[model samples]
Target: MPSYYDIDAILTDSQKVPCTFEITVPGLGYLDGNPGEPIKEGTKVELPLWLGEMLAVTQNNTNTPTLSLDLPQCLSARVVNALKADPRVVDIRALAPHFYALGSRMLELFDEEELLDVLTDTFKRRAKEIADQAHHPRGVLGEGAEFLRGLDESERQLFRSAHESSKAVRNWMVDLKK
Candidate 1:
């Protein structure tokens, strides 16, 4: 579970997801760029996860949800297939800054075993690359610059931690050598 003040969690929730309305919502046309008109039934809109999740899970008088959430385009088959082909090559940051975090949240709402597997494998593969980049002396001018730029928020943090730890260890070793 994400903390109440987790900025990454907030951003992840703010990311848009496609939603199809099961019922017409009156005076909510602002969501679809029309004011004062009801959003019609079967209308599809891209809504933020926070609002969409609430609307999706809420039971109306009929005991059915008002709308249904679909996987975001960031997690579409194309992106998944790319990751399956080469996890290190896909620009996950372009898809979503908090890609893995959003994936975890989606997995909670959806029962997708394949998505889980792909995400896990992708993370494991990219983690090795991130660690290598962190330990290596290749600065921004290095060959891995493009790959480093594609890392998601969590991976960025991991790289920072790994880099900092290595730096700290080197400093400690120098102090001991004195």
Candidate 2:
């Protein structure tokens, strides 16, 4: 579970997921942009993950779920295929700023083995690349600029940590020699 005050968690939960109403919801049309109308059954709407997950697990008067949630577009087949084909080339930051966090959240609601494997593999590959880029002294105008730009928030943090660690180690070596 994510910490309540974690900004990344908040942003990840704010990502939209497609939802289909399982039952008619009175005065809930505001979600679909109509304030006064009721949301009819089977109406598909894009809702933030937080609201959608709540509605998905909540039981209606008939003992049925209020709605069903679908995978967000960011995790659609195309993106998954792209990641599988070449994880390094996919610009995950453009898809979602908190891509890994969103994936972890979705995994709690879903039981897709392939998605889990793909995400884990993708993260491993990307983390290696990020570490390499961070350790290597590439000036601002050098290679890997595009790849760095495509890193999601977590990957950016990893890059920063690796870069700082490398610098600290170099400085320590200089001090030892002095």
Candidate 3:
């Protein structure tokens, strides 16, 4: 997912260069509801990409179009509807003389091994790519540079001789391992 945000301008009575300042904000965040913050009325905030993208967008906005981050929502039916339709949610049902029913063994149906296998496969593919790059190094000293031809990294910090900048291509591969 990609992070996305919107910019806003707030007009204030000030003595500086401009009365109105720019406000930028990441569209997606944890959405912690707090007192007295501005929320975009109908925006549906998504996860993962929202945080990082918001920062980049705000940085690009500079002083004007300044970011107003993590704003709070106003009281509205749209907000109420979003909460009610949340997939994991169950509405509370009020009834007199209602008794509990037996629970189902649904939790046991989870495929833990399949999940782990997918994760492991992804990591292994990444590792193999790094290792291959190490074994067959490429660098920029020339088209056929003599960088990291046979070297692999052992630690997070990569060091290469200044004379062998061309030989440092292996670090690029080693970086994948990290």
Off by over 4 Å in 2: none
The numbered model that scores best in lDDT is 1
lDDT of 2 by residue, 80-170 (tens): 9999999999999999999999999999999999999999999999999999999995877788988998999999999999999999999
- After TM-score superposition, the amount by which residue 93's alpha carbon in candidate 3 deviates from its true location, in angstroms, is 44
Residue 18 of model 1 has an lDDT of 97
Question: Could you give candidate 1's per-residue lDDT for residues 1-178 as a string of tens digits?
Answer: 7799999999999999999999998999999899999998999999999999999999889988999999999999999999899999999999999999999999999999999999999999999999999989588889999999999999999999999999999999999999
For model 3, the local distance difference test gives: 0.28
Locate the minimum summed-lDDT window of 10 residues in model 2.
137-146
The segments of candidate 1 whose C-alpha lies over 4 angstroms from its true place after superposition are none
C-alpha TM-scores of all predictions: 0.97, 0.97, 0.22
Considering TM-score, where higher is better, how would the candidates rank from best to worst? 1, 2, 3
lDDT of 3 by residue, 36-125 (tens): 454333433322223323432454424433332231121123433433344112111111011010000111222345333432343344
